[model samples]
Every structure is written in C-alpha cells, then in structure tokens.
Target: MVMVMVVMGETATPAHAEPAAAGSLEADGNDEVLTSKFTYYSGRTLADPSKTMIFSGNGNVPLAEDIAKYLGVSLGNMNVSSFADGECSIKVNENIRGKHVILVQSTCPPSVNDSLMELLLMISTMRRSSAKTITVVMPYCGYARSDMKRGRERSPIAARDIMTMIETMGADRLVCVDMHSGQMQGFLSPAVPSDNITAIKVGALYFAEKMVNVPDSASEDAPRRNVVVVAPDEKAVSRAKEFWNVLIEKGVPEARFAMVLRKPNLEEQERKEQPQSAAAVSATSVDTDPSTALEHEIVGDEEAIADCDAIIVQDIIDSGQSMSNAASALKAGGARNVYGFATHGLFSRDALERIDRAPLDHVVVSNTASHPIGYEDKPTDKITWISIAPLLAEVLRIISEKESLNPVFRLPKEQQ
Candidate 1:
C-alpha cells in the first residue's frame, strides 16, 4: 500500500474533514481512503499532484522535519557539516531516483547563502541520483524585491537572473509567496510552473481574531472600533480588499467598509534609467497572465466605512515606511483603532520600533516566513502571531487533489 502525494492547483477540491490518516495507502472501497496517508505539510504553494513522490528539503534539517511530520511521511535525513576552510559538505539519505522532489527553503537574511547553496546542491544531488522532477519552494523569496529596484550601476535584470539560476539548477517547478511586486515572475523562461500564493487570507484571519471588540462589545472607554482596511501603497490595494472581504464575512454590515488607496505604479517608476544618461528600460510583464502587471487601483464606495468598526491593515511587512505612514494618515483622519496584519514579519532596520511608536493598537503576522522567536525583542503590546499552518495544510490538500482552491480562500473570511 503506497500513499500518493498530490500537488494542488487553483481548481483543486476542498478538504472537508481531517481523515484519520493511514500511514500506508490502503483502500477500503473508498478512493479517498485509498490515499489516506497525508502527503503535504502545507504553506502557500498551490500545485497539483499526479500520484507522485514529494521529497522535501530546506537546507535546515528541523524545518524539513516539520514538513515531514505534517505530510505524515518518514522524515528524510541529511548530513551537512563545514570544513576548516569554511566550505560545506552535504549528504541526503534518501534513495530518490526518478522521485518527484520538493526542496523547501526560505532565503531569509543570514541563511540566504547557505540555503541557496544547500538547495542547489541538494537538487543537483537528486538530479545526479536520477530524480524524475524537482520543485523549489522558496517561501520568502528574498531577492524578489530586487527585481524591480531602481538603480543604474547595478544590473537592470538582477531578479530575472535569479529566476534563471533556479531554473538552470534543474527545477521542474518554482513557488514563492507574496512577492514585493507580482511582476518579479517575468524573469523566468517558463520552463517550470511558478506560482505566487497570497498571504492575504492568512492576514485576514489574524485580524479577525485579535480585534474581538465589535459594536456590541464597544464600551465607553472602548467605543466600537473603526476597522479600516488600509493599503500602504497601490500595490497593496488588492490585499486590502482581501482584508475588507474578511471584515464583511465576520458579520460586519456593509456600511463598515473602507480602504486606503495608494499611488499607482507609473511607467516612469517601472523604467530603469541609466544614471547620468537618458536611457530607460520599460518594465516587462512579470506574470504569465498579462493583466496582472497593470497597477492596482481600488476605489471603494464612498460610504465604505462610514459607520466603521475598526481598520484591518493587510500587508506582508510594515518596514515602518509604508505601514507607519498609513497609520499616521489613518490617525489624522480620525480612525478609532488602527490594527494591521501581514504574512511575513521582516522587521528590518528598527521597523518594529517605529511601528511601536505609531498609532496602532495591534499588528498580526503569520509565522510562515520567520519563526516567532526573533520577535521577542520587539514590543509585545501590539504584536501577535497566528499559526497559518492549518490553512496552508488545507490548501496543500486541495492542490494535491486537483480541486478548487477558492473554498480555502473563503475560509479566512468566514473566520471573520
């Protein structure tokens, strides 16, 4: 009895209940039970499965262990050590010849080099071992923002170069989470399927839970909070709408709706102008879908949030630059309480401190990008962590089953 692992797609089916997972695939006249064993640990990558073998890797052994546990698979072991000259050695103890492999690695700050090199080597090792397919799941996608950076001396196509490198490493597929800009996907040669999953659903659920006070719970000291879904800039308008959708689902009436719009991405901003010269390069379409590259512009109804409850800010990071600025404007505009939610908490360069000083009551983020241990130094008064693993797990199931992903996308809104 062999269990089948499936990667899910946008049209994947929903997992209604957690089946009593069988270690080995066994069928009792039920096709669902036939594949009873869990196959995916879940993050945000939406892919489909075709009864394939999925081997997980992320450079670090612990994270790989976590993924294995969630997938209900025997954890694959690895041996990695350094030499006196600071070089690294690697050994994967899995016989993965012709196996469909998934190497999970989030290139966070210090671990970027190690993770990249290890993942590359692991893929190469698997390739040499004759694995059938390789998919690299880089959760944070560190250099993603660099794809659209405005600089002259540096390469105008750094992000695309990274995409090229990943493909050259023998990856059959690539999946990254909410990129700084969706257009970053344009660099690839389309040899593989690259999916960008949104953390908005995760962010929505976080805000819905933390901000418990509604009109009924509003006291004199704590009047019904005004929940405004604010996007720091135009890029976040879609994410803000996601937050707004959650607010509506959480029993908030239609009147309590509003979103802060940001300036659109002008063609000039997307241009790569050579310093001291008039040469400018137009930004290429970053997504397989041509329509996605267009700038985001959300124009909510005028009565949106006319009698609001609270503001739910949705984003991937605060960085104190965008979220802080939006908080300032919301405070000045007389927002009752400014609460926020992001997927990845990359609080670099005193971002947490600046958020602490801002007019915010709470900020929710998921542990999908970085672990919660690092945020202990940040002010705890307004910070909260939501475990998105469950949601991610469900999404993984749907993708593997070839079912629709819309149901899971709607679940976070239901939590509201």
Candidate 2:
C-alpha cells in the first residue's frame, strides 16, 4: 500500500495513500502563488526515467495520455501517418533502446483494421529498435468475440489471428481490459504473456455509490431489498454474480439476482402473426449483422421484478439490441427503474438514440473502448461513462515494477 506521487522532478508520498489521487493538487499553496502538484506511484523505491517509455497509438490517444500523465512520463515520440492509398507509416521518433515500451491502443469500431495495423507497426518498430520489453495495453480487445468457431463456420478465429500477429511481431506481454471470453488466454500462452483484467470490479464500485438507496427493512438474509441484478445473457451471469458480490461488500443492501433466458421462436412466432420491429429493434449497429433477433425472457421469480429496481449486467453492448430488449422486458414486467452496467461501451451507430427511447434509467460503461463510443461531451442522461484509467495506470505500475498484477486483476478477499 505504499503510494508515491510523481511531481515535477520529485517523488512525494500521497497523504491518503490512494493511487487514484495521483496528480491531485494538495491544499498547501497560499494566496501569494497558487501551486499544484501531480502525484504518481511507480511501485518502486527509486525512480528511473529510462526504465519505462510509454507510447500512445492513434487508436486511443486520450487514454494513453492519461496513463502517461499518471506515470509522470511523457508519451514516447512516435509519428504514425497514412499514405494516399491508405498505407500506414510509423516512425519511433525517440530512442527507446533498453526501455520497457508500453503501447496503449484499443481496436474498437469504425476502423478496427487500421487500429490493429498501427499497433502492430508500433510493436514491430519498437522491438527492432531494441526495447527491453513490449507491452500492448489494449483496454478493449477487438475481434475477441471470434475467439472460438461458432457452428462450424470456416472462418479464421480473429482473436487468435490478432494474438498471433502480436506474438509474431515480438510482444513480450499483452494487457487487455476484458477479452470476450476468459478462454482466449489459452491462445496467448507460452509465447506472449497476456492478462485480461475484468472491469466488473470497477463497475461494481461505481454502482454501489449510485445505487445505495435501499429499503429500510432489507436484511442480509432476505437479500432482495427492492433491487434486482439482471444478467442479460448466460455469458454474463458470472459477471453479474461478481458485480453483486462487490456491491454487497460496498455496503449496498443485499440484492437479488436474475437472468435473461433465450426463449426460442416465440418472437419469430410473433413476427409471423404481427410484425412490430421484432420486439425492441435498436437503430444502433456496433457490430451490425442486421439479422440478429432480440427475444429474451426473465427466468427468476417474476414477482421479484415488479416494483423493483433492475440493473442489467453485461460484458459488451455491441448492437445494444439485447440491452434494449432487457430494459423493455423489465419495464414491461413492472420494474420501477432500469439501470445497466456494461464493461465495454461499444456504443456504436445510434445506440444513444435506442438507449434514450428504452425504459432504462442510466447505463454505466467503462472506458475500455476509446472515443466516439465513450465519454462523449454531448449531454445525455441515459449513459454514464466511467474511467478505467486509474486501474490501467495501476496495472502499468505493477508491470513496470515486475510485481504481481493479481491484486488489481481480482477483487480483494473481502470484496470478493
């Protein structure tokens, strides 16, 4: 729990020993001159500039910039450009020889190909330039959904392909926020070390603060307290459980858990009888196929949803179709308020519009994916953007110090 602060040319210990307070100004400046200090913890006894050089790819400059500021190091000078016919040019402008090179990039939306290519070029260039270690800090791992073959489709596993490219290009380690599947780790082993940090812990803490209003009669044994955690799909059940555990640890009243079960052709049957936008048709197209259906049912005690607050937990909200359906279903079931916690806000296409029209109160998402999809300046009440920047900065510090990332990778025993 040793917290270090990165001020200009000096190391100061944070009074509160909190890593998130890095770069926060202390209240010591008098009226004569206002002075502020930036604090950063390197997880080290001695600070050395040559030890680490962080670089920001074009995909996520803002996040990379925040990480750099947190680490008290400037982003390594690198020039990335495109040719007339859409070719990529990369130049490592700074000498990064013998430094632990950390590159931050997220392959998400609009131009996944370009983003991936830029990251690959950066890794290749840095490796050839003799960097000691190359770590790819990808908060949102694109193409991760294709980790395994689905229904004998003769398609290259895109997740494996991306990992292979990185391994072939000489990456020492890969740090991603959340892979679509935890099993994707098997693909990176023995060649490149990979860490998939889940944002559930981050989301749980956030919701605990906003979702603290509980019924007075609520008890640990009862555990339903007018709030219900909804798992949008089977894949998200584990994440929902994790979120609930963290919420309870954060002192929110005990909550109930439920899930959305995929009921077969009910929607198809409805479509034939009376077609009406197929249930809850969303205009958003994060990963559009234009053919996916939205038909799900609540699988717990039906009475639990009535007059209760519902928080839908999901990993990634791609088209937002499932989310829209879940919100509509919960509201139709008489749920009072519907909130959402999605780890990756791939708020593609017109997701904002869909979310606005849906019966959801607010959807909290992590900045695992970069801009255009996250932290928009335009005012919106349905979405709340949370930053994993502190979490990323903390992980980078642990990596730089050659320490275990388990502390950040998992919730503490108490929280868990």
Candidate 3:
C-alpha cells in the first residue's frame, strides 16, 4: 500500500521522507504549510497517517493546528471565503479521494450561523470530492441549549435541526466537548455515531494542583482540605459531581458537592406575559436575557460548605451571571474562597467585565471556543485557559485506528 500525506501550502510529502519537527513550519496567512510524518507505523492495526487528512474551518484554526501537530500530520489545505451577499464558499485545495477527512470547527457565538455554514459546506465538498469518511470535530456545538421544548410555544428543537442538517450533508461521525445536554446525541441519525466528551477532568486536575498545599484536618493522618463543588444550576449537578469525583481521585480530601437553585424572576415573567409591539421588541431580546432572568440560592449541607473553599462547575459560562450569582451566594454562606470552572466560555455581552467584578477569586475555562482578537493582550488576571487539543487529538487517533472510544470517557491516570 502506498502512503500519501497532504501538507499545507507545500507539496505532499512521500511516505519514506523524514518527518518534519512539530512547529517548524510557521503558519503564514491562509497558505501556511504544517506537515509532519509518523515516525513509527507497526501495521494496519495502527492509524495510517497517510490516509488521514485534517482541515480547519474559519472558526478555530489554532486548535486545528495543535491537534494536527499532535497527530504528526499537516492540516489539509482548504480556503473558506464569503461572497458579496455573505454566503459561505468553501474550496478544498487538496485531493481527498478515498481519504478519511477530519474537520475541526466550533459553532460558537458572535457568528454561529456563519461558522455552522462553513462546516456544512466543508462536509458537502468533502463528500463530493470522494472522501472515504468524514468526521466533524465541533468543540462547541451551538444551539445545544435548545435540546428540549420549552414552555407551551411551538418551537423547533434547534439542536436536532442542526444534527439533521449535518447527517444529511454526509458526515459519518460527530464529536463535541462538554455538550450542554447529553440527550442531544439522540438527535443525530443512528448511523452517525456521536461522542460528547467532557472537560471536567481537565478542570478538576487544575484545581487539584492548586489545592494540593492546603492543610488537612487535625483528626486525620492523611492530608485533606475542605472543598465544595458548587453547581450553578440544578442541570449542572451531575457536572459538579463528576468534577468532585475526579478531585477525590486526585488526592483532594473532604470534597462535597452542592447546587445553586435558580429563583424565578417574577418581573421578567410579567414582562414576557405582556404583549410586546414588534417595534418595541429589539432583536437582542428574542431570547430571554439570562442576566436578568433568574436569581440564585445555594442549597447544601451548611456544615459542608461553610468556611470551605468553593468551586462552581458548569458546562458554559454565557454572560457570567449564573457564575457570579453562585459565587456571591457561596460567600454569603460563609465560604472562604470561591472559584469557577466552565467547559465553554462564551463571554457574550459584558461577561468578561462582569466576571472580573464578581466575587469569584479565580476562573478556569477550556479553550473549546476561540476568543476575540486582541483578547490575549487584555489584563484579565482572574481568568486562565487550558487547552483540550491533546484530548481531541487522542480521540482522532483512536477513531483512525478503529478502536473503541470507551476509555476516553473517563479521566486518564495521569490526570487523576
């Protein structure tokens, strides 16, 4: 069998050629080349890097590069542009005939529709180009919060709609990071297998290291620190519990889990009940503004949380209201310090500023979605970013090797 590896910008490297070192190729504009060869290939049972090709949409190029580097392959050449009318146009610069294609894109805020369109176009183009298989790596699946019907309105399940579009467009598999609801996987076609991975373990390991130096109770021989994992809402209780479990396994002692209940906002409900004139209703208010829609109330064992450090865990942090409210409530309940961890940080509106002013001492988020340009230069001392590229790269490798992905659901030994 002949090996074929498509390198960005440069010509395809032959199988016998020596692999280039990772990060040796600088990404130059849209025509950058990033190529590397797999040094060891035992047999067909392992992933044939030559047959695999990875591409990135306009949404998150940096993350795609990181994953490609990890797999010892270059990102496939692709160009995504927009027409005068704002329609997306995708051009695959490489020949992907009979090759397994992986596309990395996150349907996130600010331009969710555009990002999603780019993904669909890429998938359709790959299918038309005779690609052997297509796997969509969407780090942040947009409209995931619309997994279920709400109220009595005849609303569409947008998540399901997006899934149908993807399946119809010819994607063979789907992968997401910390999907807002696990049930969303059922929305996809049965033939299209989906994996909803979590970043809770990643967040847990980060906190474990920070809290490792805390003192243990005098009565116990082993060192232990009192810590409480707080869920921002009832829906996030499972996430908080998962984080707590990992913390325990990572040698964090005396960990407890709690949930913050959202109190109904009577004022917001009344406003919704009142008929609104089309002229009065702004486009932004089409969805309920989370910042003013609910109040938070902490509920858990008082002795467990009082005077203990608190870590609020959730899937997404949009607007930062829920996180701020939970942290404020925890402090009022006598919690000594408060921290927050969210898988996706969609800092919409004034979220970053709100988080900076909130009572949370520190916050950690996974780099599932790309931040705005120039955000890196900002002095956001309370926020830290952790990359999920390694986890995603391993998943891609496993899929290419045709291995069961059950092991990836749990925290790795090193992380624990």
In candidate 3, what are the lDDT values of residues 1-416, reduced to their tens digit?
22222336322322232212221111222111211212111112225778988998877777787777767778898778877678788888889999999999999877899899989999999999999999999999999999888988789999999999999999999999998888989988789999998878867765676553245443547546578998888889899999999888877756888888878879868887788887656533323332432356778887877888889999998878788888877877788888898999888766787788788887778778887444566747677666676678878888888877776776544521
C-alpha lDDT of residue 197 in model 1 = 68
Error of 1 at 191 (Å): 3.2
Clashing pairs in 3: none
User: How many backbone clashes does every candidate have?
Assistant: 32, 5, 0
Winner of 1 and 3 under TM-score: 3
**What is candidate 3's CA lDDT for residue 319?**
77
Candidate 2: which pairs clash?
5-40, 6-39, 6-40, 23-38, 23-39
Query: Residue by residue across 1-416, what tens digits does model 1's lDDT show?
Result: 22222222222323323321221111222211101122222333333333334444343333333443344444444555555665655676657776666676676644567656666776777778787877676666766666754644455556677778788878777766676677877667667867676766555543444343234343545444445566656666777777677656754434244555545556646452423332221112111221321222334543433434345455566355566656655555555566676767666645666667777676666544554334645445566554444544454455455577666444431321
In model 2, where do residues sit more than 4 Å from their true spots? 1-46, 213-225, 266-295, 373-379, 413-416
lDDT of each: 0.53, 0.71, 0.76
Which structure among the candidates has the greatest TM-score?
Answer: 3
Best by lDDT: 3
- Give the least accurate 10-residue stretch of model 1, judged by summed lDDT: 25-34
lDDT of 2 by residue, 33-125 (tens): 111111122333315656888887667676676666666667777777777678887887777888888988888876788889989998999
Candidate 1 residue 304 Cα shift, in angstroms, is 7.6
